[model samples]
Target: MKHLILCCLLLCACVAAHAHKPSDSYLNLVVEGQSVTGQWDIALRDLDFAIGLDANGDAAITWGEVRARQSEIDAYAMARLQLQAGGKSCPAAVTEHLIDDHTDGAYVVLRFRALCADTVSELQARYALFFDIDPQHKGLLQLMYQGQSSTAIFSPDKATQQFKLTQPSRIRQFVDYGREGVWHIWIGFDHILFLLALLLPAVVVRREQTWQAVDAFKPALWSVLKIVTAFTLAHSITLTLATLGVISLPSRWVESTIAASVVVAALNNIYPLFRERRWVMAFLFGLIHGFGFASVLTDLGLPKSALVLALVGFNLGVETGQMAIVAVFLPLAFYLRRTTLYRRAILLGGSILIAILAAGWLVERVFDMKFLPF
Candidate 1:
């Protein structure tokens, strides 16, 4: 039974490690009278999959290559996106094309203008980019109308949406971003595992190189409080800085370091290092984890008016999700602290599996390869 449960847990860890990836596009549209002008930034990697971008098969796409295929790129993107005003289709006319760098990778930027037949009131957008190729693809929209900006995320189910040409609602924006924050934490398997690895040892004390359950709950609760507080403070600082464009780091480095942190945290469970100072580990690693969270928020491209509210809502939502996980885990761990299942099966076996999974993530992120299917 123990071996069977261990195998099942390891399998889950493997699947979750691959569930996260970089797949998003930015769309900013401005409405003026009976016209629409906008910029669409699509990932070159996705374009390469749809239509070949690497001309010579040299594994590198150049400006010359992308420039040469400007017409094709425009046709492909415009066809996928349908803009309508007053219930009439407004075909896009590609004005200019360029390449830009985002946190994830290189993107092809298409600037275009759309002229509508009637006065603009209810603007509709139907985005289907990369849906057939990658269902995980998300089209993030920043719409500006009547001097007010609004944000929306487009997925397969919610692809077609209509925006009103009026002032944006702060309440809607806060709720939307808050839900996204909670969803991100749930899908962030590496972050969850790292926190779990740190928490697994919280209810126990180290004695002669072995872990033993604590008699009083106060000590364990205090330990968790300190660790959680440190992690929250550290990540909050970095997340704010990165989102506000104060500091930036390469996506590859941030992702690889996050995976490495998970490995180190899990390994520290088996081999004691900095014993009882796990809060230090949480604070240091939580800093890098902030960058991971910033990627999603930055990609949304929130306007100045809504930035502070969105950031606060998103951060609170993340903390709510984190507390939910702790609420379920801490009680069960405390109850089973004296059992062999908690020590051998959960702590040792689970930590080993998490370490293996994190090492796989490190390899994939560093080499930019897809070794697992999520």
Candidate 2:
């Protein structure tokens, strides 16, 4: 019992910490012969935190402020990124500075050119942006060489990476995207909460206006299987379509709807709608969640040559992560299904808390404002 309580507390802490999307920057490099040209998009919010983008303390950043600090921004970013070709350094210089808007917020765009000492067959890069302050920061890199595209993600643990410009590895791309899919699902708090909301009542059935624990675990496991299957099928459809550019939706709409789905799922647990057919709800809302997942892949820019392999790997990774969550949750929930603490506190109280938090997310995403501290 004490362990469960501690676990719940730790979960709440993680939810608070990740209430907002973690920081990420996009980098695209084009390699031709001995020349390298690239663009880096760094979030202004991150830069402001790192090097005071806002000249005044008004809590608002403007183009004037950004232009005034352009030199400092260039220096800060350039110092963190290094490029090398064929075991020789390729010194780079900023060609242009601009601003752009991403789904998250405004970003500073740096366009640069690097001249290699020899014809480039292999390229190496070292990226350390925001790693000192925000360890979770990631650099999404897209490399284009000889009409072929490859992608890689840079993290604090793996900040420096080498790429073979001659031919990108299909196996490496599959593994990288698969790993990213698992990481995204694990950190995706809203998705986790939505799944938990559906699972909360699986071990119990409502009878005579009250909840009663099931006599055996088989029924609960079956219920979970249905819900998970429904969600998996629904999201996989949209994730593939959206990533393939067959369908597209605005990021704001997708994010707001996803939050709304979480709210509805959690509220249904407290209100007991669709009690016997929860899989239906999962299927319906899981479509919207798929779009949310697509945003990550779309940003990564899939390689056209090995697109299917990468997609399959990522989808499998998502399923693996989802099943792991179920493995941990189902046994613990079944063990305590008949307990008053599980019935009252975990199911009811936890649902209420999830609903409230998701409601906050819905409002913030819809209004384009930040009300929560995170």
Best by TM-score: 2
Candidate 2 overall lDDT versus native: 0.88
Which candidate ranks first by lDDT, i.e. highest? 2
lDDT of each: 0.85, 0.88
List TM-scores for all candidates, in order.
Answer: 0.84, 0.95
Model 2 clash number: 0
Report how far residue 299 has shifted in candidate 2, in Å: 0.7
lDDT tens readout by residue for model 1, 1-374: 65545434433533455535457899999999999999999989789989999999886789999999999999899999999988899988999888998876789999999999988998999999999988867888999887788998888888999888888889888987886677677678888888888988998999988999999888989999988998899899999999999999988899999999999999999998968999999999999999999987888887788899999878887888888777777776787788787788788888898898888888988998766654
- Clash pairs for candidate 2: none
**Lowest-sum lDDT 10-residue window in model 2:** 9-18
Give me candidate 2's TM-score against the actual structure: 0.95
Candidate 2 lDDT tens digits, 6-62: 447424623553553568899999999899999999999899999998788887899
